[model samples]
Target: MNKKSCLNCGHTISDEFCPHCGQKSDTARITVHSLIKNDILGSIWHVEAKFLHTLKNIVFRPGKTGMDYIAGKRIRYNNFISLLLVLFGFNVLSYHYYEKFAPAQPLTDDVIYVKDFFSKYSKIILFVIIPMLAINAYSLFRRIKLNIAEHFIIGTVSLLGILILFLLSDIVSLIGLWKPVEKIFNIIDKIIFGLSILFPAITYWTAFKNSYSKPGLLWRVSVLYVLMGIETLIITAVLYEIF
Candidate 1:
């Protein structure tokens, strides 16, 4: 085989990849086959691997995952912002379909308007809300000494977990069994809502405990829950006023 120059940096190379710039040496002419196989399919698989790895860590070891990512061990996980965007897409799609296909309940104009507004602006709302939560977290846990950006990363992971629960709740609500038994459906809805809130609290507590080596686990967890509640209330009030 002839030694070829690196297309990226013009360095001479004999191996399959450029040592200087790390670009693949086999940069052949582009074709439809190569585009589909290497670019589209390969990228999908790579993203899927990173996403699932990050999700597993977020689900089982959220604090350690957040700490690792903040500490610069990020090759194994998807970026926090990327994950948040994916979650937002999933949330919007799931809720939109749920509202469209599920049996309609008679809602007042104000209630319908609020729901529509939230559905349209959920991502914008989250963009604002997550930073506020991050600020509260940083303030409450200043003893740990992490900066606001690190806290924001932690907040994003916590929100990702909540988004998963929210998707699950939407799935459960779409089940056909709910139509016949109004009482049962309402009860299940309340339960799912409660679990959505509780799971995120647990997620945040675990992540905080792992990320920060603080002494007061119980106290920290309690205070964190309080902060979350306050944040939720404030967000709800703001949304209500806006819509």
Candidate 2:
């Protein structure tokens, strides 16, 4: 019998995968089921794996992870922009469902407007804010000597750490409990908030220490905290005016 030829480039091959074009020798005919399983389901699984791996690194080794990605070691990590978009999408959907089903007080017109505005413009806001924070980092850590783009990567990862903390807080809030459970949830909420702030600060500090030869960890962290506070104030003012 004649051996199968590569479907992709018509190269004659004997092994499972074609050496010339890398097409599988036993490539199956296209069908609805094949498309759904191979294309759709496979893509979803791949994305999920990458997302989970990236999240783990960002949570546990944020400084090293960002540095690795910037240095072009990114096969295992999800694309930074794609990760941010996915997180933002989750935020929007979770907030929408929470408002619809949760037993929360009716939102005031201003509050509702603010929520809607942020929901619609969250990506744009982040694009603007992240670069600004990157610039702030560059100015504050001039001794580190990282370029603007490198600092942007650090900013992106730091923000992702904060977003993950926010999601955890949201998840905790979803727990419906009686008096004792409610008290426990409240305590958890406070703890999550504290960690949200503390963790990101640590992420930046460690990233800086690893990226450059730095000594004054406390001084650098203090300056970063001050920059964050200033940025938060500016953002609050902008939102106040818009709403």
Best by lDDT: 2
**Candidate 1, 1-243: lDDT as tens digits:** 789899889999999989999999998998999999989999899988878888888867767777788899988988788778888788778888887987768999988887777766667666775787678778777777889999888878777777766776777777634568756766776786786676645655676664554556566666877876787678777877776
The CA lDDT of each predicted structure is: 0.77, 0.79
lDDT value, residue 56 of candidate 1: 82
Off by over 4 Å in 2: 1-42, 106-127, 176-180, 211-215
Q: Count the backbone clashes (under 3 Å) in each candidate.
A: 1, 0
Report RMSD (Å) for each prediction in the order shown.
4.0, 4.6
Where does candidate 2 clash, by residue pair? none
Stretches off by above 4 angstroms in model 1 are 1-5, 12-22, 25-37, 113-117, 176-192, 210-215
Measured by TM-score, how close is model 2 to the native structure?
0.75
TM-score of each: 0.75, 0.75
